[model samples]
Target: MSASSTRPSYAAVLRMPYATRTFTAALAARLSYGMVSLAVMLAVSRATDSYTAAGVVVALFGAASVFLSPLRAALVDRHGPRRALLPMASLYAGLLGALAAVSWRPGAPVPVLAVVAVAAGACTPPIGATMRAVWGELITDRRLLQRAYSLDGVAEELLFVSGPLLVGLMTGFAPPAAAVAVSALLVGLGTTAFVASPAVKGVAVHVARAGARTRLGRGLVQPVVVAAGVGLSLGAVDLLVLAFAEQRHHGENAVAWVLAALSAGSAVGGLLNGAVDWRMSARLRLPLLAVGLALALGVAGLAPGLVTLSAAVAVAGLFVAPALTTSYLLADESAPPGGRVRAGTWVNTAVNAGSSAGAAAVGLLVGRLPLAVCFAASGAVALVAALVSWHGEASPDVRTGEAAELVR
Candidate 1:
């Protein structure tokens, strides 16, 4: 096949009914998850009257997700996505609702609220893992899979941009309790849509041969480690952005717009990934990403106004999702036969852990040092990740593909 012919088109994937269903489910999940986030922040802020407490609540959520993600992936690996969906969906919805109820109650205990947040966060299934598994089942062609993942990246950017704003709107106009309840409903609907799809229904669990191990080694696979480092670096960038907003005295509203700019950049990056031909090389993508991050931080540090910072951040963000896409592609390539599901899950877990650790570390640094210092620190981390990725050996599977192509 010609190189151009070998490239997959998003339009072709979209034409498939299975793709449509998966996209719908993913979109709904993003919306619900986004809504709950906003609602929870609002409710927690109201109840505790402390931004620090709100941060703790958010951190707790990340902690839970980090810990539970591996277990969730194991469940998917053993039982398939369909059977694993119900418990997670139910617990997430119920706990979020309970959180709202407690937030509404007069003089609610802070410890109780903290506990609720932890439970709700931990119960969140590895949605990204599940989605990737779905794509793996539905798209057999590597190029097509690339396009599908790129599309998914775009979808994620859209959610990041719109989710918080939508939540703000809902909470501003309606009661906080109402917003939380609505978020739960949306999550339930979205989760239901994903698990109930015909493609998802047909997903089969992999049964190991009697002699083979039934469980994954649970070790940090190489790709998973790299992806996690990327994720943590991104989280540091996020914290730096927040610090910038605060230092500039940009008020609460500026936060959303700044985040939106980053997200818009990510969406643009994803689109670029989909449009480009040939499987992208890590050496190329990683260096490009490092430059992008450096430019963003440099600009933000030099610029005085929100407008300049926003533009810088957006330009810098253009590399984020593509970097993620590259890592995911690498993970997919490295995955053992019939091990794609678990491998994907490990990636998700590593990412969550990275984000949590990065946020906490950067948040502390910002508290003790200058915002510019924090930005510099984050940029340095990104550069290090880029360097490591550039020098790392290619996965055996990718090497095989290249060798096969050379022979042909």
Candidate 2:
């Protein structure tokens, strides 16, 4: 049988020794991230009775987390997951609990709430980066590692989707503060289990600390740039899709369906991308995928109505996960030996910053530009990033090493 005809690689990823246990713990802990933002926002609003106050507090929290992510990841890389993750998670969870307690009662001071939330976010464990580094340590085959990253990305996508749902369910009967508390508990338990995993123990002992001491080099630029572009495009598309729906006389709820189609398409694309073992290098494939996403999103703005827009959006979504998964792989390969966590954190931070900037930029443009022009502008962001990456030739060593064959 052909290699393509073999059993699914995803199952093989799970079956790797201690992979299942370690991964589940990471996911459980990571799910807290998905829950915390929504939970905190609702809780703070309830406490302060002002949406403005809540938004500011949430923004401060997010800014702290995003800006400090590299530093947190570096700690994990330098001291290993056990030494680094445990203290961070513990402190983060404690702050979450404290925030929940303060938010439980109405009329809490806004400044107090913001201070605690920022502290919590700053202490947020570098769980996602650490987990990716673990995947690197356990999976030796580059193909298998790609599959692992793909699977991890898809699972995380779902977690974010479900996290809010989980919180919403809790808020249906319990207070929003209760959900925040639950998030705290989840991270605490999950991190404890994660550190206890044999794989992490082994990783702590064998992984080189030398890479952690050195700075991440220029090899990370393309992946970070492309990832930021992907984020910008996706964020703008969310608003653009809504604007398109509004113009077409579609109800607000209809936009959700279109967005859901995008999500489904991304999930499917991530899986298929992982299943393939391509011959082209990731460095080459990275820009092409970004371009593919750009083109699909550009077509989306021209759709006649909701149906056509949904289809176009779905097509755009198909490239989302694949592009990000490829970027993460590039980050991993380009990172110093033990600095994979820190490198991945940089890519993650860029994606987030880009998303925020994209949303703000679109909010401004929606009032000024034609919707089609706005859509094209969004796509152009990714196209520009692709052009930059395409022209920026890799060093000879990188071209032959981490940027090895990943596409046709």
Candidate 3:
């Protein structure tokens, strides 16, 4: 049978022209992100002989990567991924290699490691945002885009899950530095393949000046706000879950399984969301999804046992993917022509920043408040964002305009 006749599933998304090759390359490069954190932490600890120094280095790396992501994405939108991403991937990979070399032996200066980590993080390729923008370029049918984004989200979830496992395997037979080096190789090779794609090469480069003059509409605001809320809750949930396990005196394995269940639920939810046809407009759907997630997390806190808690957390997971997918969909709808990458990066930046803030906030609160109260507060953060979004959707502009397209 012709590939064009592929059944209406996620398979159809991959079958789009140049979709398969481009997506495969992007995923290969992105796997490095998953492996990099663990490998870097291990390499730095052994090199500096201090976990505290290792953590500081890792935090610096993450701060540079997460906070500076939008600027790099803006560069890609202005220059096109080929001119922009190639140099970034090249330098990022090289830094990883240097990090590996220094971290291979003991007693590398902590300041030296910190500098390299920040440099590497700053240059890290904006593969995820670029891939999302590529999906925008490759597909215009709203449903197919939904499928593509859902598939992308699920695959990313799996990549992070498997990345650490791969690192563990490598470290068993070789030094942690080997995993770091492998991360470098993967991004270098994968990004090379990525830029060579006809679809990727075909991506439009906006005039930097025109892109600068154009402004994002209200359509972008709800998604970014809700995304931040989702991220904050999730970050708090991670630590809260750990506290839950500790309170019961449960082993580490118990925590692992519960977290795994959350990922599993998110994957399942993403697939299901892609397949369904929704009636609500994305502007409207955005708030409701957040409400569902917030409520589920609230329920999670009230559970009396691990099994019940896991079940509640799983329910929360179900909303996670759908909410984020809808946020991306909304961002795409709102972005100025050729600035899709930067717009999406804003949503990403909000989420990461929120996660960092949430973890820090909860880290302080968990020490003084009841665990159940902390979970409710975490959920409350999302609920407040949802309420604001609902109010925004009810505004005259949203109701009279833009509500015409119901993104699902």
CA deviation > 4 Å runs, candidate 3:
1-8, 205-213, 400-408
RMSD from true fold, candidate 1: 4.5
Q: Tell me the TM-score of each prediction against the true structure.
A: 0.85, 0.94, 0.94
Which 10-residue window in model 2 sums to the lowest lDDT?
399-408
- Alpha-carbon lDDT, every model: 0.69, 0.87, 0.87
Return the clash pairs for model 3, or none.
none
The better candidate by TM-score, 1 or 2, is 2
**Ordered list by TM-score, greatest first:** 3, 2, 1
TM-score of 3: 0.94
Tens-place lDDT per residue, model 2, 1-408, is 012333449888888889999999999999998898899999999999999999999999998998899999888778888888899999999999999999999999999999999999899898888888888888778888899999999998888878988999999998899999999999999999998999888777554455445667667888999999998988798898888888878899898889889888899999999999889988899999999999998898788888888999889988999999999998888776577888899999989889878988999999699888898899999999999887664567466554432221
